[model samples]
Target chain A: MSDKHMSSQFDADLNLVSSKVLEMGGLVEAQITRAMHALNDFDIEIADQVIAAEETLNTMEITIDEECSNIIARRQPAARDLRLLLAISKTITNLERAGDEADKIAKRVKRLAEDGSSRTVNIAEIKLSGEMAATILRRALDAFARLDTVAAAQIVRDDKAIDEEFRAFVRKLVTYMMEDPRTISAGLEYLFIAKAIERIGDHAKNIAEFIIYIVKGTDVRHKSRDALEREALS
Target chain B: MSDKHMSSQFDADLNLVSSKVLEMGGLVEAQITRAMHALNDFDIEIADQVIAAEETLNTMEITIDEECSNIIARRQPAARDLRLLLAISKTITNLERAGDEADKIAKRVKRLAEDGSSRTVNIAEIKLSGEMAATILRRALDAFARLDTVAAAQIVRDDKAIDEEFRAFVRKLVTYMMEDPRTISAGLEYLFIAKAIERIGDHAKNIAEFIIYIVKGTDVRHKSRDALEREALS
Candidate 1:
């Protein structure tokens, strides 16, 4: 094949792999959204569906990783292409882990459903926080697809707000538990769900970091938000 | 340079990178061990130390990742060497996350220390489980260093035991919190600590999976424990 033909073929392969990563990201987003809804409404069916879909997420992770490995071996892609491949492989793991966090939330909901507790604790704050977490994740994935470092950096900054919301929700739950020990079980479940959402936010931040790295070849992980934003702009 | 010398240089570089990964693993193990001790004794100093060491762990992770990228670019390592680089990079991330879990445990300890609650709950189970988690992590890293798939598989199996212990601990803590709402704050802290230890075990399992992939060239993640055991035995 001619050089131009080979380059175009490689681009096609890269595009295919990128599309698969996006597909996996979409599924993970659904898992988070469904799991949160399950918690909010005490829907066992949605929770069970999230649990069932975990296997599919796991399969997607393995397939994407294998495809990355194959491309690396076959193409020996250099510099930017290589960095993107590395980022994609790492991003999938984070996405699958975010799915695992969602699955954890679903499992808690499943237990709550089995208990059949009629005591409706106020989860409004949790609901709002969960939405924020999901939005951050969706926006992070969007930044990744577009390689938008500015947007990625902004999402990384957004994680702090989610974390603050999580802490506030936990404090409120603690007060509620103190007021009525009867709510402890359900309250504990909500705490875990809140934590799961916080972790999802962290995974989204990780994806954002990957985007920054891919775009600028800078390792922005573990850096302060201030520094990251400056670097993203630079 | 001759082919022999070039091959030797590549081997040296790989060894250096692998050793760095092991070093990072050692720091993570220390973090877990110290965090557990701090939780058991309410040693604020040890907790502070763990918190302080987190920066070093983060730095190590970034350095090791960069080294892996450099090796891939310079050596263009193929097949087994390539797989090892990928696994090392991933394993370091898991180790760093496990370190983060330890840091979370330490931060909780810091809060508990300030609260000055004189009530001593039965944390023996949690301590044992934490030790088990640390042991599994150490073994997983050793397996990676030696490429021992059998040891990795055993570590993977061992994670279930930690999960069982975590669940039992949480149930007991929940009972304590319900029996005496006064213990709710500390009890919740213990719950978070237990969850962190459980997550550390998960990171160990992830490392074990990487080791298995490095050895057997098969993705064992998302499979049933029974299936994983069968594959191990096979």
Candidate 2:
């Protein structure tokens, strides 16, 4: 192939790579949302679906990573392409971590379903978690697709809300456990679910960081995502 | 100057640069440890000390970055020296993030000193956090001083410990607030402090990743740090 043809081919491959990453991001985002939904309603079937989805998300990450490495090695991309590859690489890490958190939630749901906690914890506790997970997952995916650093940075505050929800969930669970000794095992496992959901929020923030890095070539991990969001939105 | 004389002079400058980075790492390590203590006791004075130390850490990071940049411009090092410069560059990023986490913890401490909780919520909480921070801090500094990937990889377990502590602390704080509405504000702030410390542990992990990169010339952030530890150590 001519040089121009080869350049177009590489660009096409890079585009393919980006779409795959975003696709993986979408899968992870959906997996967490489904897992959250499953946890809230004790829908073992939905939870199982999320569990099965984990393998897909994991494989997509590996695929996208391989593609990125191939492009870097063969195409020797510079500047923006380099940023894109690096961001995608980091996004894989974030997405994989998110998938892990989703799996944990799914496993917690399975245990909770088996343990039969219908009469123990209130639905309000679980719903809050599901809602927060859904919101963050959507924002994380949105940021990735748009390469929207500002939107991604602002998504960090969503974590604060998720943290609040987890905080409230744990409090309610612990109180129920303390009040009724019968609720202890269920409550401990329930708190684990809440922790997993919180982790999903963290990984979502990690996704947002990938978006920021891709768009702005800046890494804002461990920075105040709230501050980053404010700056981006402004 | 002759080639040999110029090379020695360059080495002298590079030594100064490295020494500053190590010095900065020492300060960052101490700040992390001290922040944990301040959080444990709500020691305003210790928090103040940490706050004061931030300037030194910032200066260290900036000076090292500049020196590295200057060395690259002037000497254009390769192989071992190149690795060292790269390590120094990445280490500066991690150390800066570490300092930020420490600063956050210190700020949380100051708030805790004034309006936050002085009564210990749970001893397990403090013990777990202190141990995690102390372990990661030690390993990261060891990685830099000895260029030991084995030592650096050890920070991964400590990071896991930090994550566990953080999750548990959030649960405990939530439990505390749930038991009584009065504990809400205090529990929330302490939650943020726990979060900051958890982030400090993450920065340490990032440093460990950089160490792996330097030692092996491969980016291994997403790999399991435990197996890496075994490989690097043996």
Candidate 3:
């Protein structure tokens, strides 16, 4: 192949891999949404569906990762192209783990459905946090697709809000459990569900960080919020 | 440089990267050990030490990841060498997260110490699980260094034991909290500590699976135990 032809082919290959990542992100977002719905309504069917979809997400992760390795071996991409491939490799792992968190939520919903003890312990905050996590995750995927560091920096800042919400929910759950031992069993379940949502937010933040890394060639993970924002925005 | 000289230089680079991984692994293992000791003894000093060490681990992860990228861009290593570098990159991420988990344990220990409540809720099982997690993590790193698929498979199998121990501990905690509401707050802390240990074991299992992938050229993650063992041993 001519040099120009090979360069275009490499670009095409990169685009293909990028699209696959977006497709996987879409499926994972659906899983999170369905899992939250299952929790809210105790819908065993939706929970089962979410559980079943996890295998597909796992397969997608493995496939995308393999594609990245193949591209690295064949193209020997350097500089920005190489960084993009490495970032994608890491990004998909975060997505798969986020999907695992969604599965955890679905499994807990199934357990709650089986128990059939619908008690009102006020899970409003947990549900809100779940929504926020999902929204942030969607935004992260969008930023990744566009390589938008500005949006990614915003995500790094937004993760703290989810963490705050989780702490608030945990405190409330503890009070509920202390007030009524009957709620302790179910309260613990809620705690885990809230934790899963928080983890989803974390995975989203991780994806956002990877975007900044890809765009700027800077590792922003493990950096303070201020440092990360400056690196991503500057 | 001659081709042989270039190959030897590449080998040295690979060895340097591997040793850095092992060095990082050693620090993480120590962090886990100290975090557990702090939890068991309510030693705030030890907890502080663990928390302080986390920044070093974070830096190590970023440094090692950058080295992998540099090697990829410069050497364009193919096949096994490429896989080894990628695996090392992924493995350091897991090790760093495991270090984060240990930091979490330390922070919780600090909180418990501040609360000054030495309640006698049976945490022997949690302690045992912590020890198991650390041991498995150590062995997993060893397996990675040697590319020992047999040991890696065994670590994957052993992760189940940690999960069972976590379940047993949670069950016991729930009973304690139900029987006496006074232990609810402390019980929840112990629950989180146990969870951190379980997650550590999970990170170890992931590292082991990577070792299998590197040695066997097969993706064993998200596979059934039977399938993983067959691939690893065959």
Best candidate, DockQ-wise? 3
Per-chain TM-score of chain B, candidate 2?
A: 0.87
* Native contacts recovered by model 2: 0.00
lDDT of 1 by residue, A1-234 (tens): 012334787988888999899999999999999998898778999999999999999999999999998988888877778888898999999999999999999998889889976245788878898899889999998898888999999999899999999889888988999999999988888888889899999999999999989988889999999999998999
**Per-residue accuracy of model 2 over A26-134 as CA lDDT, tens digit each:** 7777787788778767899998998887777766765676566556656655545666765676567677877888888898889889878655877575667666776
Candidate 2: segments with Cα more than 4 A from true spot: A1-6, A43-76, A114-119, A123-126, A148-192, A195-199, A202-206, A209-213, A216-234, B1-27, B48-117, B120-125, B153-206, B217-230
Q: Which stretches of candidate 3 lie over 4 Å from their true place?
A: A1-6, B1-6
Residue A97 CA displacement from its true place in model 2, Å = 2.6
lDDT agreement with native, every candidate: 0.88, 0.70, 0.92
Judged by whole-model lDDT over C-alpha atoms, candidate 2 comes out at: 0.70
Quote model 2's iRMS. Answer: 7.6
- Candidate 3 lDDT score at position B118: 51
- What's the residue-level lDDT of A101 in candidate 2? 80
Which whole-number lDDT from 0 to 100 does residue A183 have in model 1?
91
- Model 1 chain A poorest ten-residue lDDT run: A1-10
Encode model 1's per-residue lDDT on B1-234: one tens digit a residue.
012335788989888998889899999999999998888778999999999999999999999999898888888876778888888889989999999999999999888887997245788778889999999999998888888878888998899999999989988888998888999988888888889999999999999988777766788898887777666666
